[model samples]
Target: MNLETIQANARSSLGDALKSISVQGVAEHSGKAYGIVALMYHRLALCEMLADVRVDRFQVLLCKSALVRIHLMRLAASGKAAHPLTTCASQNFSFVDAITAGQLDLAVELARLTSDRHEPRSEYEDDFLLHRFMQKRLLHLHAGEDHDFQSLMDRWERIVEGEHAPYFDVCRALLQRDGEGFHDALLAVIEERGRLFRQKDVYPEDARRTDGALFMNGLALLRLAELNGMPTQREYPNIPHFARLPVSKLPLPLDSWMRPEEGLPV
Candidate 1:
C-alpha cells in the first residue's frame, strides 16, 4: 500500500484500540487507575508515531521500544499473563511496514523469543550480524572517508567480540558482495539494523547517531555515484508555481552605502 493508505489505516486502528480500552469501572483505586490509563495512553502515542510514514528509522526504533514496554505493562495488568489487549495491539502492527520502513519487527520478535527463555546465543548472533551490516553500509556510503570508515569498522569488530557474533558473520557476507548500487546496499543495511534495534535495545543513542551519520554519508555517496557515471533513479522534476514575492528583501548592510575610508586615490 502507498504511504497515505498505510498512515490512514494505522490511525483508524489506533483510535479504535484506544476507545476499546477506555471502559469504565476498569479503574478501582484512583492512583492505580491513573497509572493504568497513562500506560495505555503511552501505547497510543507510540502507535501514532509508528503510523506516521515520515518518521525516520531512529524514531521508529524508539517507538517500537516503547511499544514493547507497553506490552509488558499490559501483561502486568493482566496479572502477568498474556492479555487480549496485548494481542490486539500486537496484531495492529503491520509487519510488512515494519520490514520495509522500520525493520523493528526483528527486534520485537527477538525480545519476545527471549523473554521467557535463555537465548543468549541467538541474541548475540543477531547482534553481530546487525553490527556488520551497519559497518558495511557505512563503508560503502563513505568509501573515501578513512576516519568514518575506521570508526564504523571498529564498532563492528567490537560487537563481534562482544555478544553478537552471528550478526557479525551475516554482515560480513553482505559487505563482501559486489555490484550492488550504493543506495540499494545502504537501504538493505538500514533495514537489517532496524530489525536489530527492534530485537535488542542495543545502544539506542549510538544507533540513532549511526543512522544519522549514514544518511548524511549517503547523500554524499549519491552525489559521488552520479559523478562516477552510476545510474540513479529519476526523481520528479520540480515545477515552478506562481506566488507573490516577499514584500521586500532584507535591507543591505549600511556598510555598503558608506564609502570606503579615504585612500590615496579617489
Candidate 2:
C-alpha cells in the first residue's frame, strides 16, 4: 500500500482502539478513569502526529476527539461532577462538537505533549515542536499577537544546552535575519541532529514513546533548512534508517501521560 492507505489503516486502528476503551462503571476523579483517559490522550496525540505528516483530515478529527476526552477527564478530575462517557452520544462522537464544547487550553496542551516526544528532548524540543517544527510556521501563519512564543523558546533554549546549543540559536537567528552564517548554522544543527539520531541508545522505551519520529524529525529539519536557503546538495549522512522504516512502526514518546503540562494542535 501507498502512504495514504497506510495512514488510513493506522487511523482506523486508532479509532477502533478508542472505541474499545470502556468508560463505564468508572468513577470520576479516580485514578482508574485518569489512567484510561491518559491512555486515550496518548494514543490520540500519536494519531494527530501521524495525521500531521500525511496531512490527513480524518486523523485530525481523531485528535480532536482525543482532546475533547482530555477536557472531559480534566473536568472530572477537578471535581466538576459530570458524566464523562455521557458527554457525547454513544452512537456518534463528534470531534468538532467536542472542541467547540470543550476547552481550547487543553487541546493546546495535548499538542505539546505529542510534539515534545519527537526526538531527544534536548535537541529537537519545542512547545509544539513536532512535524518539521510546524508550530512556529503555524503561529506565523494563523495565530494573533496574543499568541507569544517567547516563553516556549526560552524553555527550549534552557533544555537544549551544550554542543547542541546552536539548535535554538540558529532558530533565533533565522527568525531575526537570514544572514551569511544562516546556512552554516542551519547545516550545523542538522548535522548535530544526525549525530544524535545515530545513537539509538539515547531514546526511551515506553508505550506512548515518539522516539521513532527522529527520521521524520530530521527530514523536517532538513526541509526547513533548505526552505530557508540552506544548501541542497550537502551530504545528509547515515539518517536513512529512519526514512527506511515503515510509517506504521513509528512510536510515540511518553510516560508523562497524567502529568499536567502544555501542548497545541497540528
Candidate 3:
C-alpha cells in the first residue's frame, strides 16, 4: 500500500484503540500489561512512519506516548498488577516526547523514579530496567547527565544472563542503536516467534499473537535511519516514504539493502 493509505490506516487503528481501552473514560479494561506496552511501541513505530511522510505529524505521534501512560494510569486505578510502565507514579511521568520537547528536568525525575530502589524479586524488574535504560539515554543526550549505561546493562545481566541471552543482546543492540546487531537480533526473535498467523486464520483466537508485521516495520525504519546516517539520537528520526511500508515481505540481510526510493530490483 502507498504511504498515504498506510497512514490513514494507522490513524484509524489508533482511534479504535483509544475508544476500546478507555471504557467509561477511565481506560480500565482487561488486557495484559505487556500488551499495553506493545501498543505504545507500535504507536512509536507509526510515529516513525509519520515522520517519513510528514514531519509536521510528529507532534501527534509524540502525544500518543502520553496516551499510553494515561491508559496505564487507568489500568492502575483498576488495581492491575504493577509493571514498570504501570507503576503508580511512573505512569504519570514524562516519556520520550517529553524529553524531546525540552522538558529535561521532569524527564530526569521520571527516569529516577523508574530506576531507583527496586527489589530484586519484582517480576517486572527487567521491564523497569528497560525503561531506565531508555530514560537514562534520553537524559544523557538531552541533559548531558552522566548516567552509567553499564549499570543498566549490569542489571539486565542479572536477569537475562542465560537462556534469556538472546533478549539481552537484542535489547542492548536496540537501545544502543546498533543497527546491524539489532537487525540480526530481531531476526532471531522473529524466527523463534515463528508464524503467529497462518493463511485463513480468524480473529480473537488468531489475534493473541504479537504483530510481527508492525515489529518488523519498526525495525525496517530503524535500519533505514542507520543507513541514512540517522542513528536515532536525541533528535527525531525519519526515513523516505518508500521505506516506511510494513516489511512483512521484506528480504533479509537488511544491512545491505538497496535504496528503497530507487525501487528494489525484482
Candidate 4:
C-alpha cells in the first residue's frame, strides 16, 4: 500500500492494541498496558515531525498520554503497577513531551513524580548525564530554576559519543544560557540527526526511524530555549516548522471510554 495507508494501518494497530487492554482488569497494571499507552503518545509525538503538523491532534494525544501516565504513576505509587516500564525516552514518561506540547498541568504532575520517576538507573556516564540534563530542563521550564548545570555539561563534554555530543552541547549551552553556543550546537545536532536519517540502515529500528524524520527531542530543547527567555532560531535543519507550532496547554477532550481512572478503555 501507499505511505498514507501504511501510516493509517499502523495507527489502527495501535487502536487495536488499546482495545486489548482493559481498565479495571488484570491488565490495568500490566506492563503491556503501560507500553501501549506510552507507544500511543510516542507515535503521536513523532507524527508531529511530519510536514503537516497537526497541532489540534497533538493536544488531544498529549492530553491522553499525560492522563494515562499520571494514572499509571498513581498506581505505581500505590503499589498497583511497578512503575510501568520506562525506557530512556520515557524516564519521566510525559513531562518533557508535555512541555514540548505545552501541557502545563501535565508537566506539573510529571514533575511531582519521584524526581522524574525514572527507574533502573544507567551505569554508563552518558545516560546519567542525560537524565540529569532532562531534570535540569524540566526544572528550568516549569519552575524557572536556574540550576547550576556546569558540572553536568562538563561531564557531557568529557564523554565521546560522536554525533550525539552536539546534542549534549546544545543542552549545555541551553543550561548555561549561551545563545550563540545554543544556536551553533543545535545546528550540529539537527544536521547530525538529519544525516543519520539519511543513512538509517545503521540505526536502531524504532520511533526515530520514521518517515518525517522530525527530531522531537530537538524540538523539546527549542521549546526549553523559548521558555528560558532565550532568543531561539526561527528554524533548524531536519526540524519542521509545522512541528514548531505553539500547542495548547489544555489537551483536547478525550472520549469517556478513554478515561484512565476507569481502566484501559477496552
Highest-lDDT candidate: 4
Clash number for each model: 11, 12, 0, 2
Q: What is the C-alpha lDDT of each candidate?
A: 0.34, 0.39, 0.44, 0.61
TM-score of each: 0.27, 0.38, 0.45, 0.75
Q: What tens digits encode model 2's per-residue C-alpha lDDT throughout 1-266?
A: 33345445544554444443333444433323433443344344443444354223223333344444555544544565554232322201222212222222332333332222333422324422322233343234323223355655666666665535655666665455555455566567667765665576764332213323323333434434443554433434432322221112112123222222222333
- Estimate candidate 3's alpha-carbon lDDT, on a 0 to 1 scale: 0.44
TM-score of 2: 0.38
Q: What is the lDDT of residue 251 in candidate 2?
A: 22
- Cα-based lDDT at residue 225, candidate 4: 84
Off by over 4 Å in 4: 1-3, 23-28, 48-51, 81-84, 87-93, 114-125, 145-148, 154-164, 202-212, 251-266
lDDT of predicted model 4: 0.61
In the predicted model 4, the residue pairs found to clash are: 23-263, 23-264
Give Cα distance to truth, residue 207, candidate 2, Å: 10
Candidate 1 lDDT score relative to the true structure: 0.34
Give the residue spans of candidate 3 off by over 4 A.
1-62, 67-85, 88-123, 174-179, 193-212, 216-266
Model 3 residue 206 lDDT score = 15
Q: Superposing all C-alpha atoms, what RMSD in Å does each candidate have to the true structure?
A: 18.7, 12.1, 12.0, 4.7
Clashing pairs in 3: none
lDDT of 3 by residue, 98-190 (tens): 343233443455554443545455435665565565566656654577877787798779887665454456667855667677656655655
Candidate 4 per-residue lDDT, tens place, 1-266, comes to 33354356546755665665554434444645655665566565455335246565655555566666666666666676553344233455466566666776566666556343234552355655665576566676777767667766776677764545887777778777899999999888777767776665765445444423666667778887887789986777666666675745552443422543332221
Candidate 3: lDDT of 257?
A: 12
Candidate 1 per-residue lDDT over residues 1-266, each given as its tens digit? 33345334534544443443445233321223323332333232233333442233223333333333344444455565433333222222222122222233332332232222213433443333342334234334434323233454566677556653433343343344422434455555445555655553564433333332233223322333443455544321110111101111222222211111111011
